[model samples]
Target: MWWQAAGILLGAVLGAEVLGRAAGWGALGAGSREGHRVAVTFDDGPSERTPALLAVLARHAVKATFFVTAPASERYPALLRALGVAGHQVEAHGRWHRHALLLSPWREWAQVRWHPRAGGAGPHLYRPPYGGHSPLTRLFARLNRRQIALWDVEGRDWTAEQATTLAARTLERTEPGSVILLHDGPGVTPALLDALLTGLRDRGLEAVTLNDLPTRRITFWAGLWRLASSYGA
Candidate 1:
């Protein structure tokens, strides 16, 4: 009986882990039919260094997605325009870089509503600050007809880590339909981007924007289930 109880507990833990991983993959749109593609997305932009980053992307002929805050888009409207002109996708990253968990439904709704118009034009792809979604985030997403986006791979370039380390981490986690998260701040220099892009090319992985991802929208009930399971976990 004791052994049986232990087995049941282990099975429950394993089930939870599996469910979490599955939900994460679904959140990242990993079930995409698009083959051998990765959406390269940057958050907390468009900063002063964004021009340099944009230049690097241009050189590599890679189009990325930028989830920019309302203030950043307002402060650097020209930069936002430049991103759109350069063939990159611009989406919402909140009014500020504040966490969704800290905001009320009205505040979150305001952020989503205001950010899209801040950038002249863009698809409705919303990535929450700190990657943790709350009830408000979900509500806003549903109300605004936006898709919640998450990354399957991250370079952690914001930590001021070495380019080699960041590139290694990105490459290690990359797979078909992977969404890679990068930053356009001082922490991610042009040289580091060069290294990362070069590595991706070597691996024969093409970088794209979220707009290029295969259509796999989660239903309302499914989305709620995932959010609940994530919080419960």
Candidate 2:
């Protein structure tokens, strides 16, 4: 019985890992539809390219969300301020781009430090790097009372892919209530953002911030356990 229990536990862990990698690890979404409700979220930024990204969004009159790292927030406090001032939602995206699976329990929590907000201080949304989560992530969420966010649509814009390709991929994957994952860091281009915004409008989707996305709160423990069990079974 003991051996059987151990095997089940191991299977659960492996299953959870696979599901996380494949499905953005239980990230929140507004669900699939043909409605005009999509959240545009950018990660790994406050870089030199961020201002341009902001400008593109502003030009389109789109309010998006930014998931910035602590070091980037520290280095570019003004950019973070600008993001907030522009009426964009700013949230946490860990301290670096390393995988959460490799972090220690303390380091995991520490990595998700908050950037000061214009409304106040601290973060309300947490998007793990690479959208990967672990048991420590759930524990951090439970302790800190933060919401874990995952994306339903992604463009892989951080790679060497062209702006047109990025735009096309995002448009291809997006559904109503999709949480579109993009990057405002080095590799992202103004053309990519512009094209994406235009593409979204063409598809009858409105770009919104996380706050604007329809969300229902779930108890952290229950949600975490449920996600694990579903994948395990």
Candidate 3:
């Protein structure tokens, strides 16, 4: 009896922690178990290398979701605007792309609002920087009806050796709805982006935005938006 109780306690703690770190109560980070679809999201973005990435995506004629910080979008409104015009989804990563879980709801709202002004906004999605959030995160997410997304696969494209090895590995490991992660940040220079873009295409997989994954239904977080809207009326 004691062991069973302990096990339950441990499970609950870990569950909350997972939700805390990933920005929502996401049991699976970025893949769909049902239809074998995948969504690719770009974080900390709209950087200098971002355009190169966008070009590669354009060449392939693929759309992707870019979760950028308020500052980044603010600085690069064109990048934000262009993404929208190109039929891509733009979401809120954070204000400075910082750990926003600790922020109050008002602060959180301010950060989210910043992105539209900085870059642009269509569907509002939030991904906490570095994948950690505070208790306040869930409350704000609920009130705002924002879906929080996290990645399941980390290609570790931040390091030199890791980038090359992980990029290939990511493709090999990907399933239909898997959210595979790659950094187009400083470490992943133009060459890396080209290789990754080509790699994804060659593997018989198409690059898609977070919303583009062939999902019949979005997650509970996303579903809440419609739920609340209907209730309010």
Highest TM-score against the true fold, candidate: 2
Q: What is the lDDT of residue 112 in candidate 3?
A: 42
Model 3 regions more than 4 Å off: 1-16, 22-37, 101-109, 112-123, 187-189, 214-233
Q: What's the ranking of the predictions by TM-score, best on top?
A: 2, 1, 3
Q: Model 1, 1-233: lDDT tens per residue?
A: 99999998677545433332335333445435348677778888899989999989999999988989888888999999999899888888888687655677678787666564544544577777767555345556767776677765677787868888878877887777777777767655666778888988898878788877653555455555555655675
lDDT values for all models: 0.72, 0.74, 0.63
TM-score of each: 0.78, 0.81, 0.72
Q: Could you arrange the candidates by lDDT from highest to lowest?
A: 2, 1, 3
The candidate that wins on lDDT is: 2
CA displacement after TM-score superposition, residue 205 of candidate 2 (Å):
1.4
Q: Least accurate stretch of 10 residues (summed lDDT) in model 3?
A: 19-28
TM-score of 3: 0.72
Model 1 lDDT-worst window of ten: 16-25
Query: Per-prediction RMSD in angstroms?
Result: 7.6, 4.8, 8.7
Error of 1 at 173 (Å): 0.8
The TM-score measured for candidate 2 stands at 0.81
Candidate 1 residue 179 C-alpha distance from true site, Å: 0.2
lDDT of 1 at 42: 88
